[model samples]
Target: MQKDIYVVGLMVDERSTKAPDVQQVITRYGSNILCRNGIPSPSRERGIITLTMEAAPNEYEKMEQELKNLHGVTVDCIHFSQQESFQVCQK
Candidate 1:
């Protein structure tokens, strides 16, 4: 069996209004997250967050869905195979 790497990209508009909720969900899935990076826009009105994760398919989807449910937040995921030479399995 081959292991998979999951990369999630999150764009949060209206940071002041949505960051708390985003933080809550990130905390809920803390164990599955391998790395996290967050950057705020120059005007401090929005934020971009990227996460590297290792999780079962179901759990990953659940986390993505949770983030999507929040207003002013957009989420995207990329899946890569660890056994291959940087092969991307999904986007």
Candidate 2:
């Protein structure tokens, strides 16, 4: 059975935020990062990044923690969509 989950992408500074550090955190919790986009900001303080991935059932907490642990980085928005399951209805 396939379960639905909310995938939360994050954007943060690269220099300020340690890449290996963040990767380690995510790896600790077992998260598959689909894609990561790095965008340069006006100030080097922190850059914007976008992550695309899928989460398991009720695994948002894990993803949240992984990203939140990083410095100067926070979850922008989490878009969740419902996934339908297959079942037979009886009369």
Candidate 3:
């Protein structure tokens, strides 16, 4: 099995009401997380978080499912695999 790199984005609509639960779920999957960055909305009522990680397909799917189950949270993910390569050329 090959592991892939994934970037996950989470948006919490009611930060004060939902942040704690979201944090707990994130903690439960701490080992799979490589780095995390979070920012609060200007009004302080919402939050956005970005996570970078390396995980097996199943591991990521499970985390996505759990996060999606939260009432006021939205999750999105982008994955990069070893089989894909990118290059930039200037003309």
Q: Which candidate is the best by TM-score?
A: 3
TM-score for each predicted model, relative to the true structure: 0.82, 0.56, 0.86
The alpha-carbon deviation from the true structure for residue 55 of candidate 3, after best TM-score superposition, in angstroms, is: 0.4
Which is the better candidate, 2 or 3, if ranked by lDDT? 3
**Cα lDDT, model 1, residue 15:** 92
Give the alpha-carbon lDDT of every model.
0.84, 0.55, 0.84
- Candidate 2 lDDT over 1-87, as tens digits, reads 333444444556654556667666666655555656767665675656565555564465556766787686666545444555322
Query: What's each prediction's clash count?
Result: 0, 1, 0
Candidate 1 lDDT over residue span 1-91, tens digit each: 3336788889999997899999999999999899999997767888999999887767877888899899999888787655554443343
In model 1, which regions exceed 4 Å deviation? 1-3, 82-91
Q: Per-residue CA lDDT of candidate 3, range 1-91, in tens?
A: 7878888889999898899999998998889899999997767878999998888878888888888999999888777867775222111
Candidate 1 positional error at 76, Å: 0.8
In model 1, state the lDDT of residue 67.
Answer: 91
